[model samples]
Each structure stands twice: as structure tokens, then as C-alpha cells.
Target: MDIFLIILAFVTLLIALVGSIVPALPGVPLAYLSLWLGRWSGYTPFSDTFMWIMAGVTLAVFLADYFLPPLIVKKLGGSKAATWGSILGMILGMIFTPIGMLLGMLLGAFLGEIMYAKRSGYMALKAAMGTFLGFLLGTGLKLLLCFYVLYELVSTWWATGFGGF
Candidate 1:
């Protein structure tokens, strides 16, 4: 049963890693769940205080991930329309995977700035670039956190003799 649980935790962590990029999955939450599962499975290396701190970080990162791109668009002189369009594009882009999502965001921001906001081409392009940069940053942050959590889990397991698995 311990071995089974350890395997399950590892699988959950792997899924969490993938979720960090997929947009639909709550990657940070899933990764946190893995830690919880590990704790329940007799891996008590992580204290409650540590878990709570991680939970807070996860929530902050999750919320920031969604808002960062739009905020960047706005910061780059994009209008509300551009911001909304970028967010909508990102959500819709989930259907097409990575490339589609990236392109959708860029196109959406550009069109929104040009057509809806009546911004000049150069300004629209700048906003789109900002959106793209924000997306990359958000993705990077989430991936980093996910990997950190995974590392913590694995290191703890290793330190504890693989959790007896």
C-alpha cells in the first residue's frame, strides 16, 4: 500500500508538471495535492507550516497566471478591448494546444488594438508583444514552481529511503 501510494504520488506530480502548461488544469493545486498525498502516505517530512506556505504560493501563482497577460497588455497601452480579447483568445486557444494558443493571443491582441481600440499598427504590435511576454513569464513561473514542488517531493522521498517503496 505504501508503494502504491508513492507511485500514485509520483504520477500525480507528473500530471501536475504537464498541467503547468496546459492552462486548463490547476497545475499548482495538483502539485500541492501530491504533497498532501505524500504526507498522508507516511511521508511527514513537510511540516504543516510548510504545506500552508506552499498552498498560499500556489494560489497566488494560479491567479497571477490568468491575469498577467491581460495586465501586460494594459500596461503596454492596450485598451480594455485588447485585454479582454487577449484573455478570450487564450481561453479559446486551449482547444488548439500550444501554438494555437500563442498565435491566438497575439492575433487577438493585435486585432483588438487595431480594430476595437483604433490604435496604430505599431502600438498594437507592441501591446501584442507585451501580451506574449507576459504569457511566457507566467508559464515560466508556474513551471518553476511545479518543478520546485516536484523536487521537494522527490528529495523527501529519497531522504526517507524512497518512502519504503
Candidate 2:
């Protein structure tokens, strides 16, 4: 049971780390789940209170990541079309992966502003830049959280050992 939990925890941690940058996966949430798996594996690196706190933090980060880009588009004078376009582009972009997602966001914001909002090129570009900034901010925050969780899990594994393996 312990071995199974440890393996599951490690695999999920790795995927969460990748997803932190990928934007398609629910990175922070997975990282939080790995912490629980680690606990169930008999490792006590963090207390229950700490885990609960982390759960709330993880949810906040996830929400921010999901909403920040569209909010930024709107804040930068982009129309609702641009906001919706950015969201759609991100989902479609997931097919190509990490870089595609960003490019797609920029293009989506730009095209939406151009075609629907009837904004000038420079204005559209500005909105796209804002969206890009939001993406960076969200990704960086998730990456930080995922790395921290990964570190704690690894430390727990190291300190506790694999049941004398």
C-alpha cells in the first residue's frame, strides 16, 4: 500500500510539474492531491492544517489562471469577443501545446479586437500584449506552487525512505 501510494504520488507530482507550464492540465490541484497521496503513504512532511491551507491556496491559483487572461483583455479595452476568443483559442491551442497556447492567445485577442471590436491594429496589439502578460503571471504563480509541492514530497520521500528499500 505504501509503495503504491508513493509511486502514484511521484507520478502525479511529475505530471503536475509539467502541467504548471503547459496550461492544459490542472497543475496546482494535482500537486495538492499529491500531497494527500504522500500523507496516505505514511509520510508526514506537512500537517493537516498545512494541507488544508494549501488546498485553499491551490484553488485560488487555479481560478486566477483560468480568469486572468480574459480579465486582462477586458481591462485593456478589448471587447467581449476578444475575451471569448482568447478563451477559445487557449482550448484549441492545447492541441499543439505550450508555445501554441501563448501564440493562440495573442492571435485570438488580436483577431477578435480587429474583426469584432473594429479596433485599430495598434489597439488590438495592446490588448494582446496584456493578455500575454496575464498568461505569464498566471503560469509563473502555478509553477512556483507546483515546484514547492514537489520539493516537499521529495523531501518526505528522502527522509522517510521506501520502507527500508
Candidate 3:
């Protein structure tokens, strides 16, 4: 059962890595959950202090993904409609392809600024840029966190002889 759980933990970590980029999954939280699974499996992969710290960090990162982009948009003079359009685009963008989310977000923000916000073309572009930059920043942060967690998990397992699997 330990071995099975360890394997499941690894699998979840892998999905978290993919989720870092996909935007559909909450990557950082899932990675933290994987670490907890390892702890629950009796591997004791992290210290109590480390676990608490990671929990806080994971929650922060998860919230950042939601708050960062909108903050950036607003700072750059984006309207509420622009934020909603970007979100809608992200959902609709999932239909065509993974990269479509980025593009859809860009388009949606532009349209929102122009139509709803009554912003000029240059201003719309600026707001769209803010949204794009925010998304990229959030994704990058998630990827880094997930990769570090994955390394910790795999390395710990390897050090323990792969838990005798």
C-alpha cells in the first residue's frame, strides 16, 4: 500500500507539472497535495515546518493566479469588462487548443477594452498586454514551484531506494 500510494503521489506530481502550463488545473495546490500524499504514505518527505511553509506558499500561489492578472489589468487601466472577457476567453480558448487560451485572452481583452470600455486602440492594446504579461508571470511561477516539488519528491524516493518498489 505504501508503494501504491507513493506511485500515486508521483503520478499526481506529474499531472501538476502539466497543469502548470494548461491553466485548467490548479497546479501548485495539486503539487502540495502530492507532497502530503507522500507524508501520508509514511515517507515523511518533508518536515513539519516545511509542510506548513509549503501549504502557505501553495495557497499564496493559487490565489496569485487569480488576483495577479486582474490587478495587472486594472493597473494598466483595464475595465471590469476586460477582466471578465479575458476569463471568458480562457474558457472558450480551451476549446480550440491549449495555446488558444493565450490568444483568446488577448483578443478578448482587446475587444472588451474597445467595445465595453470604450478605450482607444492603443489603450486596448496596453490593457491586453497587461493581461498577457500577468498570465505568463503566473504560469511561470507555477511551473517553477511544481518542478521544485517534483524534484524533491523524486529525489527523496530515489534516496530511499525508490521505497523498495
Clashing residue pairs in all predictions, respectively, total 0, 0, 0
Q: Which residue window of length 10 is worst by lDDT in model 2? A: 156-165
What candidate 3 gets wrong by more than 4 Å, as runs, is: none
Candidate 3 shows a clash count of: 0
Q: For each candidate, C-alpha RMSD in Å?
A: 1.8, 1.9, 1.3
lDDT of each: 0.83, 0.82, 0.86
Looking at model 1, report the run of 10 residues with the lowest lDDT sum.
81-90
Q: Model 2 — TM-score against the truth?
A: 0.89
Quick one: ranking by lDDT, best first?
Answer: 3, 1, 2
TM-score of each prediction: 0.88, 0.89, 0.94
Q: List the residue pairs that clash in candidate 1.
A: none
Query: What local lDDT does model 1 show for residue 2?
Result: 69
Clashing residue pairs, candidate 2? Answer: none
Q: How many backbone clashes does candidate 1 have?
A: 0
Model 3: pairs clashing at backbone N, Cα or C within 3 Å: none
